[model samples]
Target: MDREQHVHTIDTPKARIQAPAFACDSHIHIYDRRFAASPGNGAHIVDRATVEDYRRVQERTGTQRTVIVTPRPYGTDNCVTVDAIRQLGIDNARGVAVLRPDVSDTELDMLDRGGIRGIRFTLYTPHQAVVTFDMVEPLARRIAELGWHVQLHWTADQIVEHEALLTRLPCKMVFDHLARLPPPVGTSHPAYGVVRRLAASGRVWVKLSGAYLDSQVGLAGGYADLAETTRAWAALLPQRTVWGSDWPHVTETHKPDTAAIFDLLGTWVEDEAARKRILVDNPAELYGFAR
Candidate 1:
């Protein structure tokens, strides 16, 4: 089987959604086989999705800015993501890297200069993490000095459990995948309230990404079940919200059409200005894009 076939194809019907200028896809991963998977990383690494391949996605989604994240496959070796940032150009790209607690200040500085704006703690993946929840507060303290934030991918319950720690972190917080909260429980979940309150603190941001991950209604419905929750967050915290396609849709049994994902944003954020805030202004401030 061709490895390239495993990556998502951009063939959805023309999206009703159109992105505003400087629209940013705030979450994505680039998997290059040259970057060896970490030991004990049980996660299945996918085919190489290079900078150019993602540009095709940009063409389809009409998003010019992106945040290239280092997935668990690369462990703490962020060569592929750092390289992608450089190729995509510092002005249009930012990155979220994964690093060990013992990483040197010199190395951190180098990554900071390489367009990395935050460190990720991906608790939702099957693989063992190089940085766990317990390490977040301490690491946030160190990165806070450099004006870097902490990005997290955790289950909804864990968000509630770690609410205090999240609030106490010295730097800003970004929650991936709508906080990964399940439906029916959805915003009624206790963690959702905590997340809302944290966003109120003016230091927390949430990515409108990974709709299928938490959708009880599944992909056939285009994850429409999440629309209400998505609208609540957008209306309540437009300035703190951003959109991401979760491109490659690696976790799903089947890949979702990226164009459809862009279209979904229209249902969630109907007001043109509010949609621009999620796609443009919020990401610009959170990721330090030049005006």
Candidate 2:
């Protein structure tokens, strides 16, 4: 393998919006070269963004808690994520791991001790994925006993197609990037209705992250379309919504100002109480952070 190139920097302004006490970022990844990417995995480690690197993001955005997610590059090997959770300390951090159904209970117990609260199904893979749709239900059933949820990264159409499956999960569910809705159609897309329905189910949480990825207008335009979608989703399910920085902005052509993204939440949820619900209260409930 060749030397990996670094991705975006953590260059961001001091967040203008002051985060409430125990504010959680709720989504992030710490990619280390020590945990090599799977040979078959399409997503490679373009950077060595560590737990320390992401603390800079947290500092810039005034987020005190974080959810460390296992990136697709490492496939089902969750060592990087687990190590990060350990490094960040379980008291202020939780994690989502990419694991298969065959993982032993003992390993899961260790992961739980390391602050893992969910399993991620990276279904949007260009190549063969380690964890597939067929694996979700069985794994969900197993992790449900451990009180873990299923975190899914699916496109809007796939979310619609698997709505029943998502609803049937024994544990709670999280939809990444607000189902990665089509930028052109925004909430008008048929899948947006399905996502709303899922949110209404009270078992699903939509991550108000990744505005940079979902924006059709590019990063320079400040992801106006995504901001609109966030406002709509927040109005419909304030309790079910949580925000993330998606720090290091992997695979993105242009890196967004994370502080700007944090401030955008203030615009979406104008009321201070409602903003607290989205940023502090909701994440506390979802990730088991102390209230």
Query: What is the per-residue lDDT of model 1 for residues 72-182, given as tens digits with 9 covering 90 to 100?
Result: 778888988999999999999999999877889999999999999999998874246667777888889889998999999999998998888988988899888888878
Q: Which residue runs of candidate 2 sit more than 4 Å off their true CA positions?
A: 1-12, 126-128
Worst 10 residues of 1 by lDDT: 1-10
Query: All models: lDDT?
Result: 0.84, 0.82
Q: RMSDs, each prediction? A: 2.5, 3.5
Index of the highest-TM-score prediction:
1
What local lDDT does model 2 show for residue 266? 82
Candidate 2 versus the native: TM-score?
0.92
* Inter-residue clash pairs, candidate 2: none
lDDT of 2 by residue, 1-291 (tens): 211122243332478989988899998889888788877766788564788777766777788889999988888888899888888888889999999878998999999988999999878752556778989999999999888899988888888888788778878898888678877788898888887777665787889988776677877777887777888778878898899988767767656667777888888778999988988899889888887
